[model samples]
Target: MEFMQADREACDRLLPGLRERLLELPLSELESADSPALALFREYGGTQLLIPADRGGLGASALDAVRVVRVLGGLAPSMSVATAMHHFSIGMLYSIADLYGKDTEIEPILERVSGEKLLVASGFAEGRSNQGILSPNTVARPVPGGYVVDGAKKPCSLSRSMGLLTTSVAVPRADGTNEMGLLLLPADTPGISVHPFWSTFPLAGAESNEVRLTDIFVEPTKILRPPPGLTAQLSELEEAGTIWFQMIVTAVYTGMVSRLAALVLERGRGAATDRARLLMAVDSAAMLAEGIARRVMSGDTGNDCAAAALVTRFSVREVLTQALDLAVELLGGMSYIQSTDVAYLTAAVHAIAFHPPSRTSMTDALLDYYAGKPLVMA
Candidate 1:
């Protein structure tokens, strides 16, 4: 309709006036590491957008969540990307909380997340070439009462501002094998520290750095182990995680490119046909993302849905890549030379391809899924 009009309205309703505040700040400030965007996001209740209303959250549906993320992506790219990780982590926890009763330990964490507006950072294995997102990046040694965790997550978004860190760890089993489990630990836990890692300037405000944990002790109650016999393929929780991650991330990049496309439309940078093609590319990608979110809301977040999410993500990546290149050209060389904003957005939009489960790595898995095989991440 009016270029993310409904999604912008959803943002205003969820976190009133957040867009205005982000707009007031310069793009350079929002893209810098010292940016106040994250703090502003926290103040605006952005952290509680995905939690269920019964648990003190607004309990927005999956469809609306992606819309909100798309709006944020247009205004503040780094904040949107960083918060996507938070939503992914919390989504996993709450999904488990729904499975288990309220008596579980996850209940308190959910309360703090909704009540305290605490941000949770995801520490899944990413940035490693040819590695699956489910692969544990941290090592957990069995100890009395719990386990000793030692490892690190590089390019971990929200590294500095996260109140809690949710990481995937390889838990030692009695038979000398390993099982994938999620570990929840407070950010202030001993041995947990953040180091400068992300050197990229586009999303420096995301606080994507190295989060190191050395000999960190975790209680048994804090670990959520997936059901057994999920070693071959995706677990239910993993599927949900994958679906949410793909949907949210795809929306973020779509918004980034949409911003550029908006500028082209506003300035009437090129011929009518060229402008129509640009809008088509951006709108198609947004619709693809919404499709995944719709599948999630319909209680269809299974292997097929996960495969569809990945397929949509990759498809959107290609569409947006072409759209971005066309937008930059349409905007003309003078616009790119006159301001840093256009260049910055161009650099940031290219990062979609760099996210986990790269196209090359997921090619075989996607082909197999298309051939009636289960979608496996390796």
Candidate 2:
């Protein structure tokens, strides 16, 4: 099932350094209301992993990206998560340009990323918002030479340190219809401000906060205007974005499961059967993601991509849920209550289920896909 062994090996070379850096950071500090984890991540060149070689970066394949993320997740779930925003955004940007010959406007941003190791924060569709990922929560109105963007992206990840923000904005058209325009802007552009908003400690180190834009002028070249009809344009972006998002996010939590197993191994406690079951679940979920990665790398963007992404998210979410439950049951109450890191990791892993296209929404979409109909999520 693991088709990309060479990519995995290349990413494996990064593990020792990643684990060392993570071990140096205290769990207490990392789980605090304020932490320097993001700084440490940038210092580690975490943003450069997935950049293409021609662009002056690590040039990790899709499989390579997923493997590295899982390792990072095992060590620092928050960092793994926050960095996923950057990795997946870069992946999606490049894929659109290279595969679909669309969104060539993102080339400049990608160049800066490859050359300077710039971090990109994603404002993609998230949980419970009801606003489809393609349907922009932020709206921009056209002006003389540019557009004036007005709206806020709530809980924007990497709020404090991102160099660029890649998001979609709803642009009003003369025909009284809206076109989705992909917007790329420097994080420190005038009128853009980040405010603390996330109160949960699970991924607190990500500093996912509120980003508000008050009539900011977005230059013409920074916007990519897609064709009309949300479903048509969105389906294209969704197929590309969902595969990487599901793979990277799922890998991160799978790393936490790995770390828990490592803890038990080091302590010489727990039955072999218990640990095997947990690891087997983790491997099953990881393989599902890897299969999707292989399909993506091979440029298979048909319904398989959509179907696999939907299935991967659902399978990983269910497996991780069971794995965490088993970990708690086998590790016992005292260890569960006393081991704060384990407790936090378990809580953090659950956040993956809430990523996007809620299970309820995906069930109908998946059925439509197999039934030879367009996949749409409201």
What digit string (tens of lDDT, one per residue) describes model 1 on residues 312-373? 99999899999999999999999999999999999999899887778898888888888999
Name model 1 segments beyond 4 Å from true.
126-134, 226-234
- Estimate TM-scores for all models: 0.94, 0.88
On the 0 to 100 scale, the lDDT of residue 73 in model 1 is: 96
Model 2: how far is 121 from its true place, Å? 0.8
In angstroms, give how far residue 40 of model 1 lies from its true place.
1.1
> What residue pairs are clashing in model 1?
none
